[model samples]
Target: MEFLKLPKRTTGDRSYGLTSIADFGTPVGRLISILDDYSHIIDIAKMGIGSAYITPNIQQKIDLYKEYQIKPYCGGTLFEKCYQQNKITEYLAYLKKLGIEWIEVSNGTLDIPLEERLTIIERAKEDFHVIAEVGSKDCDLDMSISEWQEEIQIFLEAGCEYVITEGRDSGTSGIYEKSGQIKSELIDELIKGIDPKKIIFEAPTAKHQMFFINQIGPNVNLGNVKLDDVLTLEAQRNGLRSETFYLEEQNANYINQAPAH
Candidate 1:
């Protein structure tokens, strides 16, 4: 059990180095089973898209997440839907009724003016931990890197607990390329302008997870992770998996590795 030293991870109800999972209406029984084993490593559970509004036993799922210390929240797409309908007031009330303490304020699909988005974040901070998501769901949305950084900076200034870089659930779009490749140049620039701890990169694939771990170390905050990949992600984070088995060495600049023969 004490064979190797792994990278330091933020554990036991932490803020940064977070792992957020997307719950696409997982059956209650299945969720319970997953939580029984991996809840300690999961920080947030999102009812993805607009599914939270229509899913049965939604309240039970939220309560289950809370019981395991996983903060449960409806996805930003649901917030976008509510904003589109001009029902944000009712939306907040609904979230509070269901006992969700976190809410993602995003306009990935719709165009919400910056001032209005910031205003919503400021108000929502009173009732929930507001996480604002940047980037458009439609890949064609023409947003420059500076614009992305500016928007994220504005969100943090407006007081978001975390600003999510959109990679979508499909692993294509936002921070990622059409081929599901990580945009290293863009990611590097974004992090240069933004604090890595306050930013959650949405990496839905094993490749994405691996890239982030190797590029930013194990303490990088990641989101949009599938429920099934929770343990795997945690494994990579701890350097227990092949993908990141040398992560601790890399973090130490390979200071401990034997020199070339």
Candidate 2:
């Protein structure tokens, strides 16, 4: 069946345009079905946290993502656990064994020093496509906007492919308040100092997704999206959904026309 042609958005060099989380227990068959419809819009498939440890037939799942041209990687929380266990080397080797090439490097939960985090990014860059996350998972540990911007620069300088703003799968931490409201001022400050294209915002909720797309344009990179919302998020990006329908330039004429009383 022919699908409607949508406006093309720049996705850099990534095969798929959006990033979605595939947590533990995601049915491989179901995932494949979702991809059959929306694979063109998805780029990265993150096996959230330590899900890779308990997920059944993980290699099969990873293979499927690759077959569909989606980059698959273990979540940063798993990397933190490996770091805590002093199994960093083994973890890298294991990821290699699984044929994974992309990885997330983050210190959201564990307080890894900035220097050490940069070192990790530098080393990880040697083997994998490192996507470093910036921000603390602990709500109380908020950093100033300048500090956030500086850290993002450090991570990018350290050779991370992209810097992710931490918005846990719950959409209530890191860059967001407990109520799921984005710290727009902080984001605005960061954008002023750095290139927004190099950063992926973790917008797990519908509101967060729409806000980012509106603020940064349709090509804004987003992460931690739930499996079910992939298509909906794409709709928002392409101005096919109500929340963003007016975003389409072609709709300007209709929007300015008088309505019937």
Q: Alpha carbon lDDT of residue 120, candidate 1?
A: 92
TM-score of each: 0.94, 0.90
Encode model 1's per-residue lDDT on 1-261: one tens digit a residue: 677787877778777778999999899998899999999889999899999999989988999999999999999999999999999999999999998888899989998998899899989999898999999888776578898899999899888989999999998889877878777888888877677888999999888998888877787889999999989998888889898898877775222232311
Put down candidate 2 lDDT per residue, 114-212, tens digits, no spaces: 888777777878899999999988887888888898899988888888899998988888999987889999987887778776898999888999887
Where in model 1 is the C-alpha error above 4 Å? 252-261
What are the RMSDs of all candidates, in order?
A: 4.4, 5.9
Q: Give the TM-score of candidate 2.
A: 0.90
Tell how far residue 249 is off in model 2, in angstroms. Answer: 2.8
Locate the minimum summed-lDDT window of 10 residues in model 2: 252-261
lDDT of each: 0.87, 0.80
**Candidate 1 Cα lDDT to native:** 0.87
User: Candidate 2: deviation at residue 151, Å?
Assistant: 0.5
